[model samples]
Target: MDQVVSEKVARDPTADYIAAIEEHGYVRIPQVFDKSTVDTMLDRVSAWFDKTVQAQSARMPRLNKQQPMVYNLQSKDIAFCRLILQTPVIEDILKHFLNDQWFSSVPAEDPNYILRSFLARSSNYQMPMHIDSFIPYTGSYPFIMQCSIPLEDQTRENGCTVIVPGSHKSNKYAEQSAIEQAIPIESKAGDLIIWDSRIWHAALDNVSGRTRWSIIATFCRWWIKQAFDIPGNMPQKIYDQLSNKEKAVLGFCSVPYDDETRGIDMKRSYDLLPEKVADYRI
Candidate 1:
């Protein structure tokens, strides 16, 4: 067996954050990226958000247009892809909570989780209390998880996130009556806050006189259905810029086959990844 974890903490570097999540259902890691780096990201995001919202407004509703959202950021820029993938210690924490037992798959070495969604959102008003996992279920492992990074300061006045402590284990949907119990989890720009998707949470109303922006992404086990066809929609230029591991996390290693003759294994090892998007997008 592994070392007696309850008695002595594991020597692994991700242990402290893991303990926080096990006890609180969420954790905020401060300064994952320095301000300079964050500033550059924010600049790009600001420009992208404007262009995206303008193009999308032609068909979207008036209310949705006010909030401004850019979906599938991985398809937009390499930097957005790196936001979730290249963060230090994050992958370890996610693996330990979501799917570290890579040997469960046929190849026995490929990762067992994939990025489900990547989007940029801004808050102009409050959101209702709810969970992101879609449906509730009891299990040792969560069906999904989320990470949010603010482009600017996140505080009560600017409409920071609020979550009920330890509520991820509630195994029930969030109740509007319980908003009084939820607490604001404030953090600075570039800081990351990750939570189990089952947690009861809401975004508070923004009254600080400006729109607030946050980059959010959801992750799930490899076999779960993605919000959209990430692998199928990956742009050729963006695909070329990603590393082997990055492509794997984006679902290149587990795309569904069109038919038997196309391929058999969805959980393929990294080496088996196609040299081009055409190889699998059929």
Candidate 2:
């Protein structure tokens, strides 16, 4: 299982993850899932990756060979859609850090933070140290946060992630000099690693010659434009399988309408979300 090597591990149910993120920029929760579930997810994600890479090979030849990341996963399979629901802790953490002034026709307990992006990839190359918060801003609070879940063991040998602690508050990108401060975060399958989007992080090269796949789902303030147009392209097969909360996170309730004929409000509540996939597209 993934263990926090330097940081004092959170072993109690009431562990202060919010505080951890506030002070250290990230927190790692070891073995949040069981072996069986990890095995199943690894199987599904691997199969999907293989099929998708093959189809997109000609169009994205360089990325296929270099990165091989899959995009718009919510529309591809029920398994990907369900990943968010399986982690209540992630939602709770997001609510505290990201949800505020989430306007609209407000609903009683729907998520205030919507998913900005969701994708899975196997790292084969070294990613330069950088921050996910593209634009620099002054603040300890982050507008975006990322949840990364590994489907298998991650070590320095297989391109484990590395991070510079407490870097989010800098409100700046990593300088080449910061590389000396980066520390490896070795983890096992099913560990949940959440970090402020501004944190400096990168992946090592996979010298092990084996696939090291992980799911990275980015959550942000409701107002931020999701990296993918999920609601516009969410397949009927996937939409039909989602709950009201899931649909909202997938942006079904927040998509802008083409005309006033549909509606003017961009942010909406659970009650406003259409139950049918046919009415999902605005």
Candidate 3:
């Protein structure tokens, strides 16, 4: 049965990913890209980092050589945009999580998911155990999810992410006991690991002496405030090149408030509503 299932997933990655995430609150999908693709991305990241350092050095004469990270890669490079927006498996999983209209105010536009943040972490960077849903919201559905793509091999020695399975179902924050039960997710280059934002997770210390390269792309419901102003900050040329769906995902269509003056307007119907409008009223 296991062999049969593995073979099935090799043919259809989306179905397997959905099942695995539903069961474990996270899933590791292997070989999403070939080695050559991974190598190209890594090279781009390295070049970006070098440019950033040169630019920053003029302002601060002595910058500490700590773990360096580049944020908002969608705006910085087209490769990241393709990886985050063009990947079919990623799009399918995001649709499953964000396309539901039950929790959205404007059902027509609310189901869209937007990129929250995209960053590449390198060197000895160890993150503290915590859940990504730090903001308070009145919804049972997951508000955010994150996809981690390693540009290099992630091993126990190089600080792979450690996670507590099924922790997303727990309504409470992670306690010391939950942290102790965390297990490392060792993966190879080009592998993609995704998890519910509410899951308790952390990265281990890198003792391998080699820089661990990984890209983290976080997505959230369209209504949630993005980490960066993607639509506003993105290069005009790149923004112009995006499709309608990509524009929606980058929050180009999400309005802050609907025009109540427009009579009999279904588009702005939910805009004039109060907080927790989805809740049943007495």
Candidate 4:
């Protein structure tokens, strides 16, 4: 069997990643998490999916049974929130691409990268080639990016993601001809694959008998509408537990002013810093 070799310890790949994405529209960082951490996450996700499926069946008489997938994972678990907000390498890469002034500026700009969507998928499923930015209501500029973290090895048999290199620069979706050239990005457990939202990508069929688990998270500029109302849907306790920076990234700072009511309540809702307030004013 072909195996993807990975580092035993985590290291920063920001410089290499920036270059790779600029040139190829995607890059993979190996062993961002240890095997134990990946195993724990996989177990938690499996348990959650089982519970969710049971609850869904109880609520409805007819059930459409299918491979388990849990969306809005950040709201579902604090562990997911920690993974998204506190992962150092992920943060570095996102800041580099989304906030250009990060290196030169002291107390770098927030970038206001909101977690637009997050989900965990397991089982035999294949996604057709598509550009996420082309979805309705998605806006351009300071582009949206997606990060995939696999809890199990991604292989040809387990539906690893296939992507076209340099497709983001094309400024157009892949035609049938271009998609024929897409290549699968085989990776090991704990590997992270980050790609531009404009890149043409798809998932291969999973012929592997066991479930193939992976988490997909998308982040975008604050101005873009999120796939979910993250803050509002979150439990009040979870919302209160997040740090100010985490809250800002999750879009607590992106609230628009009440032009109709001219209300200050929106401002009062969050403890926004001077810089954030200034950015909001613009």
TM-score of each: 0.89, 0.90, 0.80, 0.80
TM-score order, best first, reads 2, 1, 4, 3
lDDT by residue (1-282, candidate 2, tens digit) is: 222523245455425777778788888877877788888878888878787875654555443366857776777778877876557788778877887654645664557678888888888988878888887666755789999889879899998988888888887877766777888888889888999988888888889999888888998877789987777777777777788877777777678777888888887777777756667644
Q: Count the backbone clashes (under 3 Å) in each candidate.
A: 0, 0, 0, 0
For model 4, residues 1-282, the per-residue Cα lDDT tens digits are 111223343254477676777778888887888898889889988888877765544332121136567777887788888877889878877887665342231135444567888888874777777788764232233468898899999888988888888777776765656657888898888888888888888777788888888988998766678877775677666666677767767766665554645434333224442233234422
Displacement of the residue 154 alpha carbon in candidate 3, Å? 0.5
Best by TM-score: 2
lDDT values for all models: 0.78, 0.77, 0.72, 0.71
**Better-scoring candidate (lDDT), 1 or 4:** 1
Candidate 2's displacement at residue 128, Å, is 0.4
Q: Which stretches of candidate 1 lie over 4 Å from their true place?
A: 1-13, 57-65, 100-110
Q: List the residue pairs that clash in candidate 2.
A: none
Candidate 1 vs candidate 3: which has greater TM-score? 1
The TM-score that candidate 4 achieves is 0.80
lDDT of 1 at 186: 82
Best by lDDT: 1
Q: Among all windows of ten consecutive residues in candidate 3, which has the lowest summed lDDT?
A: 273-282
